[model samples]
Target: MEGDNIEKNRWACRHVLPLYASLGMADEVERIWKVCEYDPRLEECTAAIEAWGKLKKIEEAEAVFDKLEKKLRSPSVKLYSILLKVYAQHKMLAKGKDLVIRMAESGCAIGPLTWDALVKLYIDAGEVEKADSILQRAAEKKSGKPMFSSYVALMDQYAKRGDIHNAEKMFHRMRQVGYASRFRQYESLIQAYINAKAPAYGFRERMKADNLFPNKSMSAQLDQVNAFKKTALSDLLD
Candidate 1:
């Protein structure tokens, strides 16, 4: 062992790199990665992909993705979606879009989570029009499929954007598609309506149409909600 050259230890380095990563020694893992004769295989790539994502080293994960050949990149739609979600979690919207295109080019079925992620990223980026466009595309692409998450994300996006009419329209469409509105979505729309003061008539009509009302106890809850929302808004302004 005293006469061992650095080159002679490369083989051992390859075997121990993953162990280092597993032990949370990211810097050591990177050091070994740079010096080791690491062969890029699907299993290794997959493990690196997962490890980098878990560590929130998104750029490093993207680097691993770049090393993989297209043929061995993602053998199934599920894995592709998993990686896309990882990109979305990093707020890498452009990368997510490119991955979606790649999944489509490979003839993979787009799952609800992928669509939901796209919609959310667009919304978070304040690209409401683009988000709407994506929803339209999703409607066409997955016709006859129930996508409750997608619909809910879109509705939340519109509500957050203060597009109550469009949000209401989508809410109706969701009901038509047999999706019951969640309480969060309902509260979001209600809060948006109240904040904007755009038209209480429509809000009142819709609430009545949906058989929802502010009873005495619910009015108390609404008062507290309004107070909290006002405080939050004030804090943001301050």
Candidate 2:
């Protein structure tokens, strides 16, 4: 064991804490904390905050954050987001929103991940418009490059609400953005049609038109379906 105190603390923070935290070994973290100094002024604070988050030690998280704020004028966006996620995990939506406000006041721009967590909170609370607004803001802040996930969530919500028009609109808008289309989005659109009591034939046709179908077998299936449509359903059976 090296007698260097700073190196030992750094090693423990960088390596030991994360490992123990992943394994849910809070006792090991505490053992290391007792033997070595825990520096609140550096990135090492992340390990402790994350460890506390894993353990649901909200008070401990607050203590580390207070120390970090006292030592360094403001915590990093990453730190704020990490703690916010922890609060969200605990269903502390009020506290999580409060922290986002505080993080903004501290001059850290709310990034996509931070907005995603807050959007999740709004969605879970049945605040669709609120979540939609947050996602719009997230899109605006990210230079009009909305995360694919944002569209997926909105489509899911619209489908659940049976708002087929809006769901289709979102799908089209995502394509207009020139983002590479994903099969999941196509599947969601089809499901939305089904939810709205609309025939999904148009969507299946569009999926083929967009070249978004998954495999060659789907093409064969589509051919057979199209041929069957040319013949009356009763005639095909006869």
Candidate 3:
């Protein structure tokens, strides 16, 4: 009878947990977790943390992480990264930094996910330079490129600050890392140029080369850029 209950709980963790989490039923998730007799899998624990994150329940997320650590005796790097991501989402810079340090001391491999989480933590904390510095250091290592979202995060921040040069630099670097240029990245670069009140020269052609057509929002932005360029040209002609 006990064995049968454990098997049912394992199945519930695999299937029911994610479904409840996605539905924003945090209470139900907690209830299911409490009733489980077997040790939860890493993915199951991650799902609980993510559920709390989506609801912006930082303490709840941390509690789940604590439980995972107690159960496993040593959680995996991915588990640590997911918890770090929850901290990042809530802009808990100090906590995130401390977690990263603990991860290093525990010899958890700082793979792309951990690097990405660290970058995001700094970015959300309004420390763009620090985030970019981490990104550069990560790139110097042989761990391949940081995650695509890391590049996009810096690009979005640079755009928000009207720092067109760095935004463009990030875009190019993202491409150099072999990440296919996507609409979100293109939109961010275009927004950078728009915020700087500068023309995004050859952007349309570049998008064409990537086989990406402008959507409604992007088309509106491009029109503004064209108007700015035309005004500048007319002023020069006069």
Candidate 4:
């Protein structure tokens, strides 16, 4: 009977924790975690850590991570990725770097999730070059492509810098990886052209091909691009 009760508690931890966490009920999550013999499975621990992360409770999340680490033989890459995401969310660059080193020292297989988290950490730290370098390395590896959001993050940064060349590169590379272009991606690319003071010629047609209609803000930006093109033409004629 004791064993059965323990099993039931474990099951509850797995299912109930994330639901409560998502609803921002951290107290209930903590209570449920404590009831699970403190031997919760990876999913439960992940949920608890994510819950604490959402609440900006870094130490609490770290405590959960430390506890989870003690129960596993080989360190779990997914667990490390989750914690790294928390660090990224809070812009804790130093702690995130240390965690990456720890993952390497522990011989954790760096997978897609880990790569995505690392990229996000660098991006959030305003280290776009480092993030791009990591993204390139991930692409060169056999593990997998970095997540779609990683590509978009770099694209957004490049757009901000008026880096049309690299922004377009990221956009094309994103498509080369078989990820379909979305409205946000197009927005980033168009913003790059706008920032660079270049006309996004035929972009409307391109959007038509992709079946995307611009929102009001994008329409205004496109008008600005057209005005720039006309001004450039006037300069050439002068």
- Ranking 1 against 4 by TM-score, winner: 4
User: lDDT per model, in order?
Assistant: 0.64, 0.69, 0.85, 0.86
| Candidate 3 global lDDT | 0.85
Cα-based TM-score, every candidate: 0.60, 0.69, 0.86, 0.83
Which has the better lDDT: candidate 1, or candidate 2?
2
Is 2 or 3 the stronger prediction by TM-score?
3
Residue 195 in model 4: lDDT: 91
Candidate 2 per-residue C-alpha lDDT over 1-238 given as tens digits, one digit per residue, 9 for 90 to 100: 3235635444545456667778888897666544433454355676777777788788877777777777778777778877777786677778888998898899987776677677766776677788788776666664346567767887888877767788888788777656666777766665565456544455466776878764665454445445545554557689
Worst 10 residues of 1 by lDDT: 1-10
Q: What is candidate 3's lDDT per residue for 1-238, written digit by digit as tens?
A: 1244734546556456667777888787776667652466677778778877877778878888888888987789899999999899889999998999988887777888999999999999989999999998998888657899899999999999889999989998887878999999999999898998888788899999999999888999999889889988999999
TM-score of 2: 0.69
Clashing pairs in 2: none
Error of 1 at 206 (Å): 5.5
Mark the regions of model 2 whose C-alpha exceeds 4 Å error after superposition: 1-22, 32-37, 41-43, 141-146, 159-163, 176-178, 191-198, 215-238
Candidate 4, residues 72-170: lDDT per residue as tens digits? 856699999999999999999999999999898889988789989999999999999999999988988888778998899899999999999999999
Q: Highest TM-score: which candidate?
A: 3
lDDT of 1 by residue, 1-238 (tens): 2126535555455455556667788886676555532565555565566666666778887676666645465456545655675775567778888888887887777766667767777766667678778767776664344467767777776766677788778777777656766555566666555545453334444556667776565455466556656777788899
How does residue 67 of candidate 1 score in lDDT?
Answer: 63
Question: Which clashing pairs does model 1 show?
Answer: none
Which pairs clash (backbone N, Cα, C closer than 3 Å) in model 4?
none
